[model samples]
Target: MADQAEKLRDMVDKKKKADKTHKVIAVTSGKGGVGKTNIVVNMAMLLSGIGKKVVVFDADLGLANVDILLGIKTKYSLIDVIKSGKKMSEIMIKVNDNLSIIPAGNGVEDIANINEPSFNKVKDELRSVVKDIDILLVDTGAGISRKVTFFLKSSEDIIVVATPEPTSIADAYAMIKIMFLNYKKENIKIFVNMAKNENEAVSVYENINKICKNFLKKEFKSAGFALYDKKLPLCVREQKAISEIAPDGKFSVSMKKMINNIFKENVKIYDNPVKRFFSSIFGG
Candidate 1:
C-alpha cells in the first residue's frame, strides 16, 4: 500500500515537471433538475465526435449520476482512486472511441466535502489520468456549494445551464453572483436549456444578463440554447446521450452548435493535464 502511494506521488511529481496544455471546462447549473447532466453527457459526445479527446469528470460527488445516465457500469470510482490507492486509469470507464468518464463515487460524503489534504491526495492520483486529454469536462453539482464553486474556479471556462423558468433563472443568477463575488469569475457562458423557442431562450439569457449587468456588473457569453424536445426524456429513460441516440435530433444539433460557440473564444491550454487538474482542485 505504501509503495503504491509512493508511486502515485512520484508520478504526480513527474507530471508537475512536464508541460501539457488542454482545455478545462466545467458544466454547472444554478439549481438541480435542469438537465445539466444530460447536457454534459451529450456535450462530451459531441465534442468527442468532432475528434477531440474528451474526458468527463463526474464531480457531482455524492449525487453522481453520469454513469447511470450513460448506462455504463463501473467497478471503480474516484473513491477507489483515493481510498484504495487505485490508479485513475483503473477507475476511468471508456464510453466510446474518444470519450471516457471518471466517476466520483456515489453517496460518498468524503469525496463531496473533501478537505485540502484529501483533495491534494486525490489530485496526485488523477494527474496521469488527465494527461494528454484535449478537453476535460467537469460535470459539477448544481447550486452554489463549495464543491461546485471549487470546480468552477479551477476550469478555464464555465458553462452555466439554465432553463426558461422563473426559479431556474433566479437560482442561476444567484450562482453567477456568488462566483463573481468570490472568485472574480466574469467570463461565464450561458446555455438556455428546454426553451420553448429561440425567443424564449434569448429572453432567458437576457434576463440573467440584465440582472448581472445591473447588479453584479458582469456580462455572460451566450453559448446558445437547447429547445424542449419530447425525445429528450426518452433518451434519458434509455440512459443514453441524445447525440448518440438521435444524432439528427434537435437537441443534438443544438448541443453541437453550443459546443462550437463555446470554443469560438480562444482558450488557454495548460501544459500538464495532471498539474492543471490538481491546481484547479486546490485553488493553486
Candidate 2:
C-alpha cells in the first residue's frame, strides 16, 4: 500500500507538469432510482458517436451499475486499482472506439469515505487515463453525501437528473440548494428523465428553475428531456444502449439533442479541475 501510494504521488507530480485540458462533467441526482446512470451511459455513447473521445468514471463507488448496464464484464475495478496496485488502464474496459469506462466495484466503502491521501492517489492514477480526453463523465452516486459533493465540486459542469414526480423535483431542488451553498457552482444543467412528453419535461425544469431562482438565487440550463419509453427497460435488460436497440426511438432522439446542446453551448472548460477539486477537498 505504501509503495503504491508513493508511486501515485510521483505520477501526479509528473501529471502536474504536463499540459492537458479535459472537460469533467458530473451526472448526479438528488435521490436514487432516478435513472441517472442510464443517462450517463447513453449520453456517453452519443458523445462518442459524434467523434468525441469519452471516458466514464463510475464514481458511485460501491453501488456502481454502469458496467452492468453496458453489458461489459470488468475484471478489475477502481477498488482493485487502489488495493492491488493495478494500473488505471488495466482496469478500463473499452466500450467502443471512442468510449471507455472505469467501473467502481461493489462493497468498496473506502472510496466513499476517502481521505486526502486516498483521493490524491486515486486522482493521480486517473490522470493518464484522462489525458487528452474530450470529456470525462463522472456518474456520481445520488444524494448529498460527502463523497457525492466532493465529485460535484471537482467537476466543471454538473447535470442533475430528475423526473416529473413531485418527490423527485423536491429532492432535485434540495441538491441544487446544497451545491450552491457549498460550492457556489453555476454551471449546472438539468435533464428531465422519464417524462411523458415535452410539456411534462419543460414543466419539471420550470418548477425546479423557479425554485432555484426565487429561493436559492441560482439557475440551470436545460439539457432537454427524455420521454419515458417502454423499450428502455427492455434495453436495460439486454444491457444495450437505447440508441443501439432503437435508434429511431424518442429516447434516442432526445439524447441526441441533449448531446447537441451540450456541445453547442459556449461554456468554458477550466484547466485541470480534477487537481483543483482534490486540492479543495484536502485544503492543500
Candidate 3:
C-alpha cells in the first residue's frame, strides 16, 4: 500500500510539472514559387478559425512575405528582437483573437548568426510569448540551403509542399532525400499543391513515396493536396485568404481536408516545440 501510494504521488507530481502541449508544423517547399507561403497563410488562418491559437512564423527571412500575403504591414521582425531589444510579443502582429504573425524580416540572413547572449534573449522571449499557443506554423523559404533546412530540422512536424510539375516533383524528392539522409527526419509530410485532380495528386504522392522507399528506404506521410483553383490567384491578388473569401471553393475544401489529416494524425507532444525550435537555432 505504501509503495503504491508513493508511485501515485510521483505520477501526480510529474503531471503537474508537464507543460501545455503545442505543435510546431513547418510548411516548406523544394523550390521557389511553389505557392508555399500561400499554403502556410491559409493553413494558419483556417486553424485559427477553428479556435486553434496559431502563430505564423515567416522563417524565410530573405524574402519574408507572410505579412504581404495577409495584407498587413509590419514594422518589426525577429531581427528587432535581437538588434533592437524588442520583445517577441511587441513585434508580433495579431491577425485575430486566435491568430498572429511574426515576420522574420526581409533580407536578414540566418538568425543563428547572432551572438550567444542575443540568441538566449530571443529564445526566452519566444518561449514566454508562445507558451500558451496551440500551434506554431512556420513558413520556411524554398530550397535546400542551410537557411531553409534549419527550420526543417528543428520542427517536429514538417509539411513539404509540391506541385504536379516534373521539375517540382524532382526538386521535392531531392529536398526529402536531404532531410531523410542528412537529418534523419522520418516524420516529414507531403502536400501536393496545384494538382489538376484528386487522382493526379494521389499519383504524385505515390510516385514520391515509391522513390523514397526504393532509394532512401523511407516514405513520406500525405497531408493531402490542393487542386488548381482560378479563384486562389484572384484571392492572392486581393491579399485575402481563400478560405476567408471563398470558403466553399476547391482550394478551401482541399485545405480543410489537409488540415484535418494533420490534426487527426497522432503526433507525439514534446514539452514545448517552440522552445526547442529557438534553442536548436543556436545549438542551445
Greater lDDT among 1 and 2 belongs to 2
lDDT for model 2 comes to 0.84
**TM-score for each predicted model, relative to the true structure:** 0.83, 0.84, 0.83
- Residue pairs clashing in model 2 are none
In model 1, how many backbone clashes occur?
Answer: 6
- If candidate 3 were superposed on the true structure by all CA atoms, what would the RMSD be? 10.2
lDDT of 3 by residue, 1-284 (tens): 99999999999888755634688888888877888888999888888988889998888866888998888988999898878888899999999999999898876765635565764675577678778888899898888976677678778888888899988889999999998899988889999999998899999999988998999987788988999999988888898898888766678767777777788732221235664465468532
Q: In model 3, where is the ten-residue run with the lowest total lDDT? A: 265-274
Q: Where is model 1 more than 4 Å wrong at Cα? A: 1-20, 265-284
Find the number of clashing residue pairs for candidate 3. 0
**How large is the C-alpha RMSD of every model relative to the true structure?**
11.8, 12.6, 10.2
lDDT of 2 by residue, 11-107 (tens): 9988865534778999999978898888889889878877788999999978899999989987899887777888999999899999999998877
Taken over the whole model, the C-alpha lDDT of each candidate is 0.83, 0.84, 0.82
The stretch of ten residues in a row with the least summed lDDT in candidate 2 is 265-274
